[model samples]
Target: MTEFIPPGTCFLDLPSPFPMKRGGALHGARVAYETWGVLNASRDNAILIVTGLSPDAHAASNAGNREPGWWEPMLGPGKPIDSDRWFVICVNSLGSCKGSTGPASINPQTGHLYRLDFPDLSVEDGADAAAHVVRELGIERLACIIGNSMGGMTALAFLLRHPGLARSHINISGAARALPFSIAIRSLQREAIRLDPNWNHGQYDDERYPESGMRMARKLGVITYRSALEWDGRFGRVRLDSDRAEDDPFGLEFEVESYLEGHARRFVRRYDPNCYLYLSRSMDWFDVGEYCADRAGNPGDTDTRAGLAAIHVEKALAIGVQTDILFPLQQQEEIADGLRAGGAQSEFLPLPSPQGHDAFLVDIARFGPAVAGFLERL
Candidate 1:
């Protein structure tokens, strides 16, 4: 019998010699996760929640605190996820800066931080690791898997890699593969970190961190995650009281610039530059079709339809924002279409919001109903 993991934050040590996709491995791999609600007698009431970049396993309020989590608006007793009816499990990604094992963790072999030495990670690796957690928890199948952005990618990977493990999937603003535009933007973000003098090729001291590069990268990310419409409506070239004449050339006059800077400042303190590099690269390299092709005796094929057809879920839902330039509505539509081609029931819901790629985070009113309806049916 599998061990029953209690509700709250905890760690699951993966079996020894965890092999990675890029031919690298970790000896003492561990995954951090959090759980809510009780597992039913049938062990089929579990819901796996895969988060986007930055969020940890803390998906909602628990015994530790009553404070709202990043997804608090949609997860609660009577909320969309309805913790009272389902057991929700959220795991930190393998290469994250959170409590999970990542670049920030000590290398068991070297007695030092993994830093750049951490093995390359892929979305499939994250999915496999999370699967181990589910198995450890004694769950034979998941009622549904819900993911957003990077989490959405992970959800697809999970379904592809572990056939029939989940009964349903909800992908929110995720893509089968990264587009050139996104790849280009992320490459620039990585460049900013690499060019930082203090970066020292990923060997900088903890005290003298690469703040400038990280801040710039974060600023760029904030711009891409939001829409021009939102900026115009929210900031509208409004000047902050602290704006200085000498800073005009640097574009600090607008309140929007100040907002980005404030967000960057807060992010730099919490995230590690090395972790960002690894995870960003991983997303760029992910291609669900590649995995699907390998499963179908064509290791080098690029048939997207063939790949999506491998999923064995009862139903799937893809949600997208109208202004989501990062992943876009077309990508979500493609997911729905691909799933249908693969012989699964699928639905596509494109929402109109100025919030862009981050709409799912900001516009809960639009997402809560769509997600709740899907889950309730399952």
Candidate 2:
């Protein structure tokens, strides 16, 4: 069934008022988004549902290409997101091609694809655009802003950039800054794309779409998202396709390789190459403290422990999955600590799962109750 979308919601595409990181301004800076539930008269029942990389505004609805929405399991009537009570909004980030302004869009000046010429996007810009969306929707304040992975980073950025925008935020599997190891991994992925002759420096207008390179990059990303322990337990030494022939390749002759290839193929088909490069680069440059020290623009100064101590909240909960290697438990703990220090009611809970960073999607039984309990108390 098509993911249920509440009635009377509208999609908005607004122009960006600022220049992009790589120079030039977008003429019609479109942001694909969806809204659900009612505004509760006061509009305080709104929840900003931030998305991870690649997915679009169809966070909980059927997409144009018959694709199931990303967070379908968690977003419906009476689900964790509870569309019946809370209004929700999800927008495709600025640099994504999934119905958002990105390299795939036509450049107004040249009337051609932006491609490599598309400017770099930052998480801050994502936050800024989201803030604009909320405002355009006539929501003065958000009850909570929830995000995962890059979406988590954007949520944190929202807290930092627009103080008091969200009463609370739930960030899942993300860090304030991308680690050096992450940088190296993304660099290698970028190399894979650039090395592919078909990429043609992001100028490929062909059908194949650097599939091999994109697949390799997705494989690398999947490896990092999980851990050796999980991979070993799930498919250790398993035969590929249940049997291998003499002509079968050695590396992909294993079940795990096939599994990774499946994920890569899906990712490559759904996501764009230049968008991947720009989004990965945004992650690389996402140090919360980078612009904060100068005070010109604080990207991580939403409310430090000392800063939060002054405010009051009914209740708060922070959750981390044990198998999530991408954003370790330590990062979630740090967020919990910040909330507590800010004097808001808060607690950190860790749940065990084998799904790695994908645990949030797969292990919702545990997460659902935790979030529901916290919300109930509030």
Off by over 4 Å in 1: 1-8, 243-251, 296-299
| TM-scores, all models, native as reference | 0.95, 0.88
**TM-score of model 2 (CA atoms):** 0.88
Q: Count the backbone clashes (under 3 Å) in each candidate.
A: 0, 2
Best by TM-score: 1
- Over the full model, what C-alpha lDDT does candidate 2 score relative to the true structure? 0.73
Clashing residue pairs in candidate 2 are: 308-342, 309-342
* lDDT tens digits by residue: candidate 2, 51-86: 777667776753232344677778767988887888
lDDT of each: 0.87, 0.73
Cα lDDT tens digits for candidate 1, 67-131: 66778888878889988999989898888877778888889999988988999889888999999
Candidate with top lDDT is 1
Q: How many backbone clashes does candidate 2 have?
A: 2
